[model samples]
Each structure stands twice: as structure tokens, then as C-alpha cells.
Target: MKHFLIIAHKAHTADDFSLNDLPGSAGRMDILCRCVNSALFLSHDLRRDVQIHLLLLGEPDPGRVIKFDGETVRYLNPDERSSGSLIKKALDKDSSDFEIRSTPGVTVRDANLSTLLSEFKQQGCSLYYLLEDGKEIREETLPRGDMVFILGDHNGVTEEEEAEIEKAGAIKLNIGPISLHSDHCITILHNELDRREKEY
Candidate 1:
């Protein structure tokens, strides 16, 4: 399975924020919504083997993780609003750790990076940190394993967050010299990986 993890540093944790005005009180949630949309859709439909993790660190709660299961997830349409609504519903719940069964997928979790990384590690995933200055992503450079790509929101991952990710031994990868939005980066990654896999 392929996993894309995005860190939203100032994503609003409260449910009072307007979905239309994602950049205002929601703290640029539009960026995240775009990212989620990219991860879920390509040309026609969803990628069955893919998963997305959103690490929300904002208002009322700091470490909230929203996971999207493409394999068996249900009721998740091919639009940003569907994902955004589900995320909003998850945030409104009062529990720090909980799961919602939707679309044949029992998903959503509230956890920190440490716990999330640990789970991924146990699943035998090769973690890769997406950064501009890191090594360029290439077909030959890609390792053989369950891959997990970690990225940040509009402002990008903080220095401290990068440090922790680095400590976890995630190889840093740069898609290109020019900086790209997180969602664009994700689309590029999916396209590249899909092309390379079909080649082999």
C-alpha cells in the first residue's frame, strides 16, 4: 500500500470554521482539501491501494490524525467537499481516539506523529519525507517496500517536525527544483509512481 501523510500545522480543530472560507478560521484548510482530493482521484477514479493521513495541529486539539482508506472506504466521493465534511465530522467528536465506520472502512484516528510513525513502521513501510532540498525522486531511487510519503501543508513542516521525521530515518526526496504546492506534489508523485510501476 502507498501512504501519503500531510501535516497541517495550524489547521483549525474547532468545527465552527466555515468550509467555504478554509483559509481564514480553518487555517488554510483549502490546501489540505486540495491535497486530499489529489490523493483520492487521478484520471478516472480512486487508487485502491492508496491511503492518506492528515496530521492536524491547530486550535482546540493539536494532534488529530484523519486517515482516508481508498481500498475499502465508502461514501467518500471523488470531490473535496466529501472529504472535508468527513474530516469536520471527525473533528467535532470529543474523543481523542476514535474510529468511524464509513464506506466499508473503519477509519479516522486521533494520534501524534510518534504513534502514527510507529504504526507505519510496524507495517513495514519505507517512509520518505518530501522536501525541496532533499534527494530528487527517481524510479531507480525508489525502494521496494510499502511506501509512505510525508509532506507538510502551506507553510511546510516545521523545523522541529522535520527533525523528528529525520530521526525516524525517513529519506528526504525532492520532486523538482521549483517549489510546488503539497497537492501538486502529490499528483506528481502518484503519476510518476504509476508510470514507473507500469513500466516494470
Candidate 2:
């Protein structure tokens, strides 16, 4: 399975934001929504082997993780607005340390980057930290088992977060030398993976 963990540094943690202003009132949630779409959507269907996790750290509350499992997900569309709606619903539900299902194939829980990374490590997931200055992705061998790709929203991953990821033994990788949006990066990564799969 393929997993994506996006750190939405300022994404709203509550369902109080206006959908009309996802980029503003919702704390740049539009970016996260787009990332979700890019991670799981294909031409006529979803990628069943993919899962995307959004780490919301905005006002009212923070440290909430929203996970979308493409294998059993329903009602998910390619549009950003629809994705945002699903995310808002997840945020509205009460979640604890344990994951709470807000919708089919969608779960919410209270978790931070460190805890989530530890969990992934325990699951034997090969973690990759997407960075601009890291080694080229094409030069590295991709893992056949479960893999997790860590990325950040508009603000990008902070220095402290980068240090934590490195300490967790995540290999740093770069899609290219040019910087790109988080959602765009996911699309590019998916394309690369798909090409490799075809070759295999």
C-alpha cells in the first residue's frame, strides 16, 4: 500500500470555516483538499492501494489526523469542494486518541507528527521525506512493501519537523530541483510510481 502524510500547518481543525473561503477562512484547506484528490484519483476510478493522511494544526484545536483510505472510500469526488466537505465532516465528529470513523473509509483521530511517524515505523512502512535538496527520486529504489511519503502544505515543513523526520530514519527524496506545490508533488510522485509499476 502507498500512504501520504501531509502536514497542513495552518489548516482549520474545526468545521467552522466557510467552504467558500477554504483558502482563507479555512486556513488554506483548499491545498489539502487538492492533495487528497491528487493522491487517490485516477481517470475513471480511485487508487485502491493508496491512503492519504492530513495533519491539521490550526486554531480552535490542532493535532488532528484525518485519514482517507482509497480502498473502501465512497462519496469521494475529484473536485476539491467535495473533498473539503468530507474533511469538514471528519473535523465535526468527536475523535479521541483512537480513530473514529466519520464516513466510509475515512477516520479521524488526535495525533501529532511524532506519534504518527512512530506508528508508521511500527507498521514497517518505508518512510520518505519529500525535500527540495534531497537526492533525486529516480535514483533511489522504491520499496515494494508499504511506503509513506511525508510532505507539507503551503508553508512547507519546518526545520524542527525535518529534524524529527530524519531522526525517525526517513530517507529524504526530491522529485526535481524545482520547488512545487504539495498537491502537484503528489501527482508527480504518483505518476512516477505508476510508471514503475507498469515496468514491473
Candidate 3:
């Protein structure tokens, strides 16, 4: 099964660049530099060909277009009439070939996590996060054998989350924060993919 892993940062989260402007965050030296970090992390312990997607969220907007780094970015442009048509149509979970386009190794500034998650699910992906809410994932959210990971925020759910995850039959693990370069992320991802990965 093709899977997409989402690394979410709320629109308000502090980073090195402006969160509202996509290119600034996507092109900034520190953010762009993370590409190597992500590559290392994802490629390290992964047993599958996993594609990581970095999703940035911010408040909804109308029809504002911003130009940066030789690319023109168009937002929802808050004033466009939807004819009552909802984004759900485009984010349908049943879509066979659906996909989400986000700036990799960078921050994505948007306001709706649910909308973003729906889009990812349409593309046959499941969300894995170390959130405090303890409900970013559900059994019915994805098929069995899917993997979800937790890092950084070990607020104490590591044990309890393991039980819930066991019940759903999803792989769960906690990797403490150890910042690495891009290639390092890839290295870590490959280790996770080793034949005896369960033993890691």
C-alpha cells in the first residue's frame, strides 16, 4: 500500500520563516535545509517506500496570490463564491487517484487540519502524530497493519497509546527527538524498514 506520512505544524507554530507566506517558509534557508534532515529521518528505518508530506496550516483566506521564488502561489482567496460547493468534493476519501500537493521539507501555512487530513486520506495515506489529544488516529481511519509514530511529545501516552494501538493492530513506537540532517532522516527511515524491524 502506498502511504504518505504527514508532519504537521500549526499555522501559529514558531519556525524560522513567516508562516502565512508559503514560499518564505518553503524557501527559507533553515526550512529548505530541513530537506536533508527529513530525507535522513524518513529514509533511515523505513521498510517501505514512504513519501513524507510536510503540511503547514493557517487561517482561511479569500483570493490572494503571492509571488515568491519565481513561483506564483494562489490561495482559496476568501471571497470566491463556492456555490455552496465544499472542499470535501475535492478531498473525497474514495477518490482513486487523489493527491495532495505540499511543499516538502518546509512549512505549509493553512488553517484546516481536518481538510488537509481528508486530502491525504484520499491519496491513500494515514496520519501519524505525537499529539497530546491522543485521538489523531482511529481504528476505522485506515486499514490494519498501517504504521503510526510518535516523537518529541511523550507526555505519558506512550504506554497507554501502545494499548489502543495494539487493539487497532497498528504499529506504534516512540523515537525521542534527536535532530539530524536530511540524509540522517533517510538513514533512520531505512533502519525502520529493515527485515527485523520489529526488533529495532
Model 2 gets an lDDT of 0.93
Q: Against the unseen true structure, what C-alpha lDDT does each candidate score? A: 0.80, 0.93, 0.30
* Alpha-carbon RMSD to native, per candidate: 1.8, 0.8, 12.8
Model 1 lDDT tens row, 13-68: 76778767778888888788888788877566778888888888988778877778
Runs off by more than 4 Å, candidate 1: 102-106
lDDT of model 2 at residue 143? 80
Error of 3 at 29 (Å): 6.2
Best-matching candidate per TM-score: 2
- What TM-score, computed on C-alpha atoms, does each candidate reach? 0.92, 0.98, 0.34
**Considering every candidate listed, which one attains the maximal lDDT?**
2
**What does candidate 3's lDDT look like per residue over 94-200, in tens digits?**
21223433332112233233444455445554445433333322222333343323232112224553444344433443223553433343344445444234443
Candidate 2, 26-131: lDDT as tens digits: 9999999999999999999899999999999998888999999999889999988899999999999986999999999999999999999999999999999999
Ranking by TM-score: 2, 1, 3
Give me the runs in candidate 3 sitting further than 4 Å from their true place: 1-29, 40-48, 58-111, 119-127, 130-172, 176-186, 197-200
Which of candidates 2 and 3 reaches a greater lDDT? 2
